[model samples]
Target: MRAADRFSFNHATAKFWDQREAVEACARAGVGIGLWREPVQEMGLEASAKLVQDAGVAVTSLCRGGFFTDPTPAAIDDNRRAIDEAAALGAPALVLVSGGIPAGGTIDGAREGVQEALSVLAPYAGERGVTLAIEPLHPMFASDRCVVTTIGEALDLAAPFPAEQVGVVVDTYHIWWDPQVWQGIARAGREGRIASFQFADWVTPLPAGVLTGRGQLGDGCIDFKRYLAEVDAAGFTGPIEVELFNDALWARPGAEVLAETKAAFERVVS
Candidate 1:
């Protein structure tokens, strides 16, 4: 299939854009989308599901469903609801950002929380035909954002569950700096744990909020072609979701951003 054919826009890339408009745009572009829970909830789960279903656009994966470092009952219950939402939207995977250490808690303890949370949710997700996709953010976010900081680590966390129930998200922006990333991708693929693959460039001179500092494709240090080659070599053939979080891009008109992102994706990785 053509590279463009596999393109999937992540809604977070255009944060302020209307969810319905984003779905329509993806449909018009004949691409797929990765949705988030907030807008889905605002639109009402059933309404959001119907919107995508009517648009005939593939919902590649739901943005998130994990933050169980503390692993309270509330957290576990929320993740279960997230799984149900993914099933409702026909999203095959629910991307998980395992929360960071709680107050006075150690990183190892936080990881344990992730495992505990997964043990409870993986089977629930599988029953709903959704895979729990663990996403390892960059180590810079290890303290406040995600405890899982490497694909290898994410894979290790997913080890106890069946591949169909639990997997990892290979997001370039987060793992590009890791020397072992290529090996991790290969291992994830070999183990059948590649549930989602996303693209984002890493730029220096990060903005005030590092979380929103991801660069557009081809605009930063990440080598898109190499990432594409590596993941492909690892045997993954799924939607290539470009999930940028740049503040500047978010400020632009969503449709224009989508068009530019699509063009950039083709230019850099095709």
Candidate 2:
């Protein structure tokens, strides 16, 4: 298939994009999409499901269902709801942004908490035919964002579960800084756990929150072809989701961003 055939626009890339508008754009372009929980819920569970179904857009994966480090029963319950939402949207994978360090907790402790969360939620997801995709954020966000910061760490977290039930998301912006990214991709492929592949460029002078500073494709130094070759060598053939969380992108119209994002993806991956 062509590189564009695998292109999926993650709605979070354009943070304020309307859910209906995003879905329609992806469908019109014959592209797949990754959705977030809030907007999906805002549209009402069944309504959102019908919207995607009617739009004929494929839901590549759900944006989140983690943060189990909170040690609250509500966390697992929310994940269960997320899994249900994914099922309703016919999404095969539910992305988990395993949250940051807990209060009075060490990194190791937080990791253990993630493992515990999975042990409870994995089987539930499995029963629902949804794979739990653990997305490792950049290490810079380790303290306040995701505790899982590398593909290797994500794979380690996925080790105890069946690959069919748990897998890792490989996004360039998050792992491009890691020296062992290729090794991790190989390992994920060997283990049959390469669940989701995404792209975003890393730029310096990160903004205050460090959340919305992602650079446009060609604006930053990420080596996209290298990542593509490595993952392909590792045997992953799946949707390539482009997720750019940037203030500039979010400020523009969603349709314009989608068009620009698709062009950037073609420039880099085609």
Candidate 3:
């Protein structure tokens, strides 16, 4: 299939889309979907799994399972549940957001905590055939959202485990600004560590809190074509999920946003 043929709509792109409807839309488009935890739980895990299975919708990746900056027993248990959910949903990867610096803790300490948590969970995830995809959020999110902010750093964390057990998320919005991004992607490919590939353009004048300001494809300065080319060259033949966390898009109807997003994706990638 062509790279665009592997397009998967990330549920976060249309934050409010009904889960069943989103699966139907993806089915209609003949594409896959990247799901999130909350909606999956809301619909009941078995029901959600059934929804996607019955629709014949591929589950690209699950939106998150790691917040082990503190590495509490409860936190690790929750992540284990996430892994089980991913396996049940037939998702090959579980996106992990290695949470921010803990309160009264240093960034270094947080990083250490993430490693510790992963060391414990990676084996568990591997046994269930789930890859813990470590997502490196943008630098701006480092202080409070994710301590892992670069592909290289994420890879280092993943290195301790087998690539099948631990890998990294190559989200354009998160890594576009890193000068070492291309190198990182290449390295990820060579190491067999690309667990997920996500797309989100970077726009200027980021909104307050800077969480919901992701740009639609081709609406900003990200060179998506270059990203595609680079990842393709690196042997990353996988679904490219478009995940935009945009306030404006969320304000509109989910169908409208999906239509627009599909058009934008075609325009940029075609």
Candidate 4:
């Protein structure tokens, strides 16, 4: 199955892991990877690109490139650079975590900023063969994270572009709680907007900033098999990237964490 064949490790899962070691670990584990921007920048984009390419691992998506709600010229320029980096790294999609409400700004206004930013970047992304995967973060992050909180909202934002240019990322941690999740998945498939499918189990009493509180595959309320069924049924045959941001996972040995995560994913999804 394409979905099963495309399992990936989101670098955020083991953030403390060294960049080179993480890529090597992913290759050793026989999985693809969703690369983060900071580490890539730190390692120097060319060096990071060469390492991943030399490892022969697929770079599913670039961790992020949006947050242009303020839409300053500087922000747009940065996004453009991200698009180029994604292309250089052979990443098919660039995940966009649309910035949260700017100071004193309403959520509605922040969303408008996302729309505007998308309009600016979508074309450039299209030209570079990089899809912009708008990730609708969980509502818990509506205040300080992403403004797009539902698959439906992401689709609406993506409606203006061809599926190849603009699309949505289905992360279970963010959308599992939505009552309308199934419908959203169906819509994404029907509209040809499922650019990336990510996974992260949901846990309660979210951490302070709600950034590093993701649950492991079998440790939370999410039903991985069911999500797999839904996305598969919706015809989304892409990499199922596990993107847990748990502090505990980050504290462990990278190889151990990767092995555990892969096993948990297989156990839950089977």
Candidate 5:
């Protein structure tokens, strides 16, 4: 397999560390990177862009861009800016975590909000050469993180748009438990809508918010090799990004974490 065919580390894995150091570590380890938005902004976009460029690391995707469940003008405006940022960093896809239920709102209402928001942003993202990858967070997060909870649902949302403009993110950590996973992957492949493929292990007794408990490769029950086979069979070829949100991992040194993560990914997928 190609080096890029293996795994890329998401900055959220080392959320507690410095952003520049994380990029450098990933490059040195010969792995690509998935960047987050706040750190990029805090370090200054121009500087962050230059740092990644200097390191010669491929950025697989930008961490986020969708939270517009309300579809307010302000929310749409923010996502537009996110698309521009993804383009600036040379990231091919922008991961969209459709916002959760608005206060005093029904989940059905939030779904509508996500659809409306995507309709508004899809064209802009397409014109800018950025694809929006809708990520289906785990069902545990359905209440407050992302309303889109399955690959099938995400594809349904993407059906009306051009494949280049809208797609779905398949993160094993989030969707591994779904019984319909294979069919979902096949559908995404048939539609040419698999924009980003991320990896992380799944463990029990999740953390409080359920946002930062992602396990490292091989540490949990996810069968990554199976996923690789399925995705490849579906004719979807893309970087496999490892996006762990573990608190323990975040507390360690960034370089150490990257080195360990690389080794774990290789062991599991080799």
Candidate 6:
């Protein structure tokens, strides 16, 4: 199939976009969508689910559901709720961002928290038919955003669970710089653990905070074709969600941003 056929516009790319409009826009373009929980909740889960279902837009994967670095019962409960949401929306995967080091805690201790949390949540996700897709952020985000900084580490955390219950997200913006990324992707595929695939570009001279600095496709240095080729070769023939977190893009009109993103995706990966 063509790359466009697998394109999914992650809502966060246009952070301020109206959720209903975004879903309709994606539907008009015949593309899938990756939804975020806040907006989904705002729209009311049932309403949000009905919107996409009525629009005939596939809900590729839910944006996030993990922050289990501390693994409190509350954290586990929240993840279970997220799993229920994903299942309610007919989303196959719930992307997870292993939270940063907790205060007064070491990174090692935090990782153990993630493992513990997953052991409980993974089974719950499996029961709901949702895959817990662990996402490894760039090492730069290890302290505040995501502690899991490499595909390898994410895989290790997912090792103890069934691939159907727990998997990893292969997002280019985060893993492109890993020298061992190719091997990591291969291993994820071999183990049937590639549950979600995302695309974003890495630009130089990052923004002050770097949290909202992801570049649009082809705007920076990421080699879209290489990532596409590798993931495809690795056997992940699924939706390729472009999930840019750029401030500039977010400031524009949602429809305009979506169009630009779709065009850029085709230009770079097709």
Candidate models: Cα lDDT each? 0.94, 0.91, 0.93, 0.89, 0.89, 0.93
Worst 10 residues of 3 by lDDT: 202-211
Model 2 has a clash total of 0
* Model 2: how far residue 25 lies from native, Å: 1.4
Question: How would you encode candidate 3's per-residue C-alpha lDDT over 161-207 as one tens digit per residue?
Answer: 99999999999999999999999999999999999999999888777
After best superposition, candidate 2 residue 110: deviation in angstroms? 0.8
Rate residue 171 of model 6 by lDDT. Answer: 95
Segments in model 6 whose C-alpha atoms lie over 4 Å from true places: none
161-236 per-residue lDDT for model 2 (tens digits): 9998999999898999999888999999999998899999987767775788888887888999889989988888
* TM-scores of all predicted structures: 0.99, 0.97, 0.98, 0.96, 0.96, 0.99
**Worst-scoring 10-residue span by lDDT in model 2:** 202-211
Off by over 4 Å in 4: 2-4, 205-209
Per residue, candidate 4 scores C-alpha lDDT tens digits across 1-270 of 644566799888889889899999889888999998899999999999999999999999998998877889999999999999999999999999998889988988988999999888899999999999999988878888788999999999999989999999999999998999999999999988998998888777667746888888888889888889998888877788999888888889988988888888788776
Q: Score residue 207 of candidate 6 by CA lDDT.
A: 85
Clashes of each: 0, 0, 0, 0, 0, 0
Q: Which lDDT tens digits does candidate 1 get at residues 146-240?
A: 99999999999999999999999999999999999999999998999999999999988888989999999988999888888888888888999
Q: lDDT at 212 for candidate 5?
A: 79
- Model 2, residue pairs in steric clash: none
Clashing pairs in 3: none
Q: In model 5, what lDDT does residue 11 have?
A: 90
Model 5 TM-score (2 dp): 0.96
> Over the stretch 1-270, how does candidate 5's per-residue lDDT look in tens digits?
763356788898888779888888888877789999999999988898898999999999998998888889999999999999899898999999998999999999999999999999999999999999999988878888888999999999999999999999999998998999999999999999999998899877677746778887887888888998899888877788888888888889888888888888888877
